[model samples]
Target: MPRNTLIAGGVLVVLGVISYVASAFASVTALIPAFLGVVLVICGLIARKKPMLGVHVALVVALLGLVGTFMNVLKIGEVFAGTAERPLAVVVSAITFVLLLIYIALGVRSFVAARRWKKADAISQA
Candidate 1:
């Protein structure tokens, strides 16, 4: 999961850089993904030392990322319909949303499995 976090962060950083460049550096807003990616990278580094703390923080960030981008994700239809005001931004947001969502899902799965394993261990000890 730590590795995955780092990878996701790397991807987001790239996405933001590309978006910013694509906009000819006119829109600082295009760097939103880069900011988020930085946070994730930090979390990933922390997780390397403390998996529980790091992953939980990452999950929270991912949840927030999803919420922040939900509206933009909805704008996908508009982009496809050629009605989106800023198609590139919308696409970037949508992509970010997907990445966060996937991370959250995988994190939740990992959490559940860990919990079950702990419970089983406790049962065996008892």
Candidate 2:
């Protein structure tokens, strides 16, 4: 329920909507971001009461984003190799990559906060 987690979730939801719109013109594969966005929103909402769960969900999403971005980067050459080039595809890909990085940052931050909270609770109880 930290402010940053809420902001991050909101950002992800917006980005997902943008990705869905972009997918209309690009490729069906673009749906990945939309899906991730939904998951992030759900996690964020749940995180308000159960931050540990949210942190775990965010970490999983971040891992997925990392893998997806890596694959996209590797396939960039193949995507542009054809003469019938599509600039929009490249732009979408770049945007996705950036969003993924943001997701990772948010996930890491939430995770660290959750860990600290656990440690503090243990110390207080002890």
Candidate 3:
């Protein structure tokens, strides 16, 4: 991994660890999505050198993950407590889902391209 990717991945790995810990406590479960966002951002940054489209998609997925987490908190608050449902949560969730689909598509495309590149390089060397 490049310097930036290694750095970002390290951060994400940390965040993921924190999130998993937080899940063990009721008070911290709500923050899980935000932590997931941090991880996604790390993944995106790490993959930046691989493909332009994939990078963009990763960034978007990170943003959506943030929104999804926020929505999850809101939904939980509304259902369990007296808090009213926040429309923002719904909006964010929708956007996040769409972005996730795009991210997966880009990831697959990048994987295919990378494979092709390796094959071409190997053939040329031979």
- Error of model 3, residue 70, in angstroms: 15
Residue-level lDDT of model 1, residues 1-126, one tens digit each, is: 898898888899999999999989989999999999999999999999999899889889989999999999988999999999999999999999999989888898888999999999999999
* Candidate of highest lDDT: 1
Per-candidate TM-scores read 0.96, 0.64, 0.43
Model 1 worst lDDT window (10 residues): 1-10
Say what the RMSD of model 3 is. Answer: 9.1
Model 3, residue 45: C-alpha shift (Å): 4.7
Best by TM-score: 1
Report every candidate's CA lDDT.
0.93, 0.65, 0.51
Ranking by lDDT: 1, 2, 3
- Mark the 10 consecutive residues where model 2 has the least summed lDDT: 83-92
Find the number of clashing residue pairs for candidate 1: 0
Residue clash pairs of candidate 3: none
lDDT of 2 by residue, 1-126 (tens): 444555655665676667667667456555655666667777777777887787577667757766766755555666567632554555455566777677677667756887899999999999
lDDT of 1: 0.93
For candidate 3, the lDDT comes to: 0.51
Q: What is the lDDT of residue 83 in candidate 3?
A: 67
